[model samples]
Target chain A: MTERGYAMPMRSQDTGRGAAVRSFLSKSPPAAGRSRLPKVLTGIEGFDLITMGGLPAGRPTLVCGGPGCGKTLFAMTCLVNGASQYGEPGVFMTFEENAEEVAANVASLGFDIAGLVAAKKLAVDYVRVERSEIEESGDYDLEGLFVRLDYAIKSIGAKRVVLDTLEALFSGLGNTAILRAELRRLFAWLKVRGVTAIITGERGDGALTRHGLEEYVSDCVILLDVVAHEQVVTRRLRVVKYRGSAHGTNEYPFLIDDQGISVLPITSAGLGHEIDEGIVSSGVPGLDAMLGHNGFYRGSSVLFSGGAGTGKTTFAGIFADAAARRGERCLYFAFEESPQQIVRNLRSTGIDLQPHIDAGLLRFEASRPSTYGYEMHLARMNRDIDAFDPEVVVVDPLSAFRGTPTEIHNTLMRMVDLLKARGVTALFTRLISTQELHSGTDQGISSLIDIWIVLTDLEIAGERTRGVHLVKARGMNHSSQVRQYQLWDGGIRVIAGAFSGHRKPSAAPVLIASGKPAAKPKKSAKKSRR
Target chain B: MNQSLDNDGAKPAGTAAHPRTHYNLRLYVAGQTAKSMAAIANLKALCEQHLVDQYSIEVIDLRENPQLAAGDQILAVPTLVRHLPPPLKRIIGDLSDSEKVLVGLDIRERAPS
Candidate 1:
């Protein structure tokens, strides 16, 4: 029991209601509450805001990650920092590293662990299990460790306890059965005593945590991981299980430096928002007129859900560039491609986002979802929202939000909350197969979306045709047509809708015909052979 | 870019302990229960083996000093700490096995010089 913050107080299960009714009721309204826990900041950036505060203060939080990742550092900095920054006493018990070893490792990252120990603000307990020196009796418990730890914790009145490498006891100790039982007992015991504890465990191969500590610690489990793509290292963290709180559910990239690890979420919290009156074209002239008043709201969430080769991201870049042209700051959270890859492709579409990137009007960030859980992704967005203060956030391919552990329904709900609260215009592109569309709940997030723009690929009689359709727009009178659209050298154009065709296009990138094929490209000498 | 790692390998070694007299014995227990009774028995056996020559066992069962739980860093039943020894060490569970108590609690028969 790691201090339950919210509770049913009665029921054991969900007896809510039918599908449609529940969907409407899902995601608790942003209600203000009276939770005044003197929460210590996680320093992992955006993490604090999403949880309304940080993880329930003064309790156990298990941070599990694979080897060579940032688990040990994350644990150390908290203690080193909580002691110095918040004036909270901390005790670090290491089953793997001694005081000296712990000190030197974190010293590079700028934590003065050695100094803290010497000053008596922090205590380090290195439990060594040397087989050469000690013989084992299977019937024994870890009372020796308890006493030593008790002494250390008391000496400093430690409000925080970090058992770095919680799995070490299982390997080095003589008994696993007894160790697991004691671990369970230890967590329960820590709660009654009231100390914020962080227990770091080695992630099991092919599993979340090696020892299955997730089943043990109930309050929260933050999974941190380093993703390697083409030799680039991006560290991420996610809240796997957060009891009684709304948290971001995306694998947001984090950075480790002298101040320790900080997770920067790209999701914008719509707080402290200032609306802009400027109505900029999406660089797709035909699609703009069909948008009734033309273009999107200053800080609204614009979603583009479609199949491949429908020019979804290409169109997104044009909007991003259009905003940059007006000198408004914009940040793009790309999940599918690196910024360089995006720049390379956008260049072909004749939209140059790079110059704006250099001019401080735009930024491009890339990450893999498998690196962390959903919360981490939200936190990472929050970090960027704070840093960039962009008037617009373009997350190309919103469908990628569905990554890892099978499903991410809760994550989308939290993300929606973050966007509304931040008041920053967000653009999310989703990938929904045509099959999923026929089955309503397959892509459940569509209804939650403020604006649903579906891009369709029409392969009528073997000649490829493209159409852009607006399914719905809440609070706005938008187009409801399967309008024809095409890509020329510069950008996109919507010609006219077959059923409900009303708007016509003018100027650059305008639609002239309902399903006009793309003009043949000026052949390059090398492409001539093909 | 392999760098030298530290933590267990660095610092002042902190293990060059000094010779001492009147070893301080602390027996840790949750409360005065049957398990504690067995711990006191096991501790007594350990004391008779090594510290009998120059020391005593002060049973600090947690039943008395509940506030002192974290001070000693107790996690489970029947722990023994040699606070008197310069380089203090700990051993948990019942102090039933005398040989383990000698090496773990570090009660070596003072090496004959």
Candidate 2:
């Protein structure tokens, strides 16, 4: 009673009394012909984007998932985020865990639940329904729960509510008919109360919830899945149904870590990014010479495909270094090599990536492709991209994604889309087996990129020479002839051969001998004849 | 509101029917609807048949005392809570299922010796 009395004017003060009266005046459900419902943003990453704004305000959103799939955490984060970020008061009523347990669990995520509770911004109430505690002897209804919930809500003037796992009612009260009827009433009552709520339920064998709570909460339903693909677990979220709004219907990958749940909703922001016509170099000495001497278009996707030891990594390193040298941030994702290994290997070519790293303009994220599922890698990449906000992103050797070709393509497409929307130039290096080079299909991502630079080895007289060929550069005049290049102490340089001349020199052997050796070849042949 | 049915105001304080014979029953209803009326009538008839003239029924309407619902842990409408006869018992429904209600309230059998 004391807490309830104390909370009466706090919510009014927070939202202002005048606004409350106006909201109460128009509290009826929208007209039948209305298609869109007002939404409340939870501020969860990618969630608002996928839902096309957020959850329908003043309505319940049912979140269903299997065990340990972050149902409770998702609901808690919504409340926490709503209260802290959106300035909306919330109440978390747990039928399963107590308030302290919920608070302690999310403490690592930097959510000060206790502080919010004390500030009257949030109210966490644990509704216990023990089978051994109460007896039902006559015709009765669950007026008790309604009263408690109402009290909690009014005390904090909460605009948001979370019922973490409503399955406890079924187990605790063993009367399905009564509980079912009461739950329906509770949902209706919550709607009447005009609070945006989240009701989490456990996944059933066939339906969304074991108790079929979906029947009662039909406004919005979101399903979470923890899919284990090849021993790597990936969490995916899909909006099953949003009653009156157009939402993203794809299964978006979400990550739950120290920052809580972050969903990677691809393209929900749409592809209408403002394009920049600026051009940036590829970091190679003569590589820009092929593209009408004007580097690549800014924010465009570039692909570097080549066989092993064809200096594809060297090309990616040079691009990243060049970007960093120009005072632009570069994020290099190395799947096959460690950061130290990339630094050491690129140093031998005299590209010197260490200064960029020291200047805080260059960041190298190295990991093994087998470390997690492909979706998990994409989720992590999305997170890192958002945090780093780099202007140029390089994924060295895109072939390292060990998933199926379709999965790799989808992931790369999503990655490029996100980067393009953010106006970040992307460079991907793909490894192609020597046998796959002649089949005319250059790695699987050639069609998805704006620029394709193919690197191959030309085996001439028992010597393998590296050749750089600009197969396609969209919207620019590009050379069609292969230019043989050699990696030296400084960098990859175009040899002073006949084909090195731009504009497709009259078809030659496309081979260049290393310096001083090919110059004295005739003299050596004469000596042998003597 | 909160009232007892067919009782003439307050009775004598010590008018215990016969110790265990006095049945103190509380029926929680949301309002005076058809279902609530049916539950009230059915409970009175069953009490008359079993504990005749010894039972007292109290009706608490949620419209009047919404806060009281939490005390008895009432989740379903038209719930009957047997307060007297030592151990408490609860039967939920409109009281249409007479046999189930009797079995649930342990009224089909005599009190334990």
Candidate 3:
């Protein structure tokens, strides 16, 4: 069994009306006390956290889902994890696929089923039943199945069992009356054997399982769903019922890659991360001066919202370059541009990131936002961030993610929470329309942001001028006056004076021409030219 | 019909007749329960009537050798498997319904009138 951190005692409020109704619906009392039910850790990432441990130990868990929702894969993962990670051996009794096919299916996920079988740590038994080949006479019982299962279990001394799609027997045999009785017996016998079991079932119209196997396996039930919103599919898992255990009841988005299924318990992370007061430079000296002579708070999330071509990516790149130059690892996520494009574009602004890339101080992960769903993108980013373990993280143009406003906000919040929990400083850029820029509405994620920097393009006297301003900086004093800045070849050069009187069309050309001399006042100013 | 004959003594006498389509049947049972005994009696009676001198019956008790259940893909007790036919077939139950048993064994049309 996997160790759990929050094995909460049974609450008194749970014994109220809701518990009574649930117990009546399940036709059993909620397993007596709040004494923690033993669980078998699945070893899938983020799954044990949500279940507080895993499936109820020495009992069957019904995993039901529609076709291709990864029911079999989930069961196989648990069984394989049990045999490999845990010392307990397992037996996979497949009714839908043969032993070789099951082995081959999970092989891509790095499970060596054949090797495990040969090592006596695992067993695979494929129960072949064809209705066309068998004729039913007067009376019969499924004792032969019991005998085969018993023999297989004893042969391997298995401590885990997976009956992948046991409902296939209903179609293979003409006797449902007997089959149902035998199924009940099988579950009872499984519990008696003291081995944790997983039984996969197809989703029915109204019930959890097509054959109503959920009624038999009352210990635990999980529902896997594949929902599509705007044509983007995301797999979700929910612990529908855990008789004696408290589990996360929310539908958690999960991912199935070569590494197998990993459920992202997004809501498990609260706003409880430890805060840091260390300061990090903004890479541009003038911008640093505007941020109270220091920079963003370490481990804080910074948001840069601006209109089109306002140099959001450039600023993000400069921040990443600065972090890398300080010998800290930085992970830069490019949503709209490729890594080569970013490196080349930043090179023109004198922020060459190729050297940092070569030195392994900065890593660029460029992907089209449409390439995956929002949850998938988050999961991939989470995996990358965990792998890289960067000190500073940058996500350029978060608005490129195509989703509803709420979805975008939720994804951003989770991303911010992820970085903050790791005590990593994060900078995220959002490309907003000109109207939203003026209104200061950043898709409702502003509250989660620590530092808000808005960059706008000022159309004055037929020349496009760039202006930068600080909207809010939590826990520190920041320059509030809107400052005019020019994107020079060296980098961003904040003009010496604030853009107070520079909004006039007549005053625009003087500032544009004096951009070279105006940047000379700052002591740490670079030799910049427009 | 010699209903008292054991499974070994129930082999077809004089195999020289009807050599091309000899019926070979294997009856799978958990033990000598009432259902198993009824299935065995029904199977022997039906064979004596339709497949006289052209059939052999082999009874396997799964209770004695449980591992043998997977070989024949047996799930239900009192199962009758036909092995000699080109396409194998299994009839599960007490075999009290001789009509379905004959049809299942592909011998209904060839039954001697």
Q: Whose lDDT is greatest here?
A: 3
Chain A TM-score of model 1 comes to 0.60
Q: Give per-residue CA lDDT, model 2, range B22-108, as digits (tens).
A: 788998887787778888888887765556677899998876787676577665667788888767776666787665565556555
Whole-model alpha-carbon lDDT for candidate 1? 0.65
> Positional deviation of B62 in candidate 1, in angstroms?
17
Local accuracy of candidate 2 as per-residue lDDT tens digits, A87-134: 899999888877889899999877899999999999887876676544
Off by over 4 Å in 1: A1-33, A36-39, A44-74, A100-123, A129-159, A163-285, A368-389, A399-414, A431-443, A457-465, A481-483, A495-530, B1-113
Model 1, B1-113: lDDT tens digits are: 11123331122223112234567777777666676777687767545533555567777766456556556545556766667765666666665555556556554442345
* Model 2 bad stretches (over 4 Å): A1-36, A267-274, A496-530, B1-113
What are the TM values for chain B, all candidates? 0.68, 0.75, 0.78
* Candidates 1 and 2 compared by lDDT, better number: 2
Question: What ranking of all candidate models by TM-score puts the best one first?
Answer: 3, 2, 1
Tens-place lDDT digits, model 1, residues A32-114 = 22355445555444455445456577778999999888888888777876787668889998878887998889888777887
lDDT of 3 by residue, A1-530 (tens): 01111111212212332233223223212222244788877877667667877778999999999999999999998888888877878989988899889989988888899999999889898998889988998888888888888888899899899998999998999889989998999999999999899999999999999999998999999999998877878899999999988877898888887657777766666677778878998887778777884689999999999989999999999899889879998988888887778889988888888888877788877777876789878876765565566899999879899767888888989988878877889999998888986675673789889999999887877678888998888987788878887776787767645776345434433554565433433434463322
Candidate 3 residue A66 Cα shift, in angstroms, is 0.8
The DockQ-based order of candidates, best leading, equals: 3, 2, 1
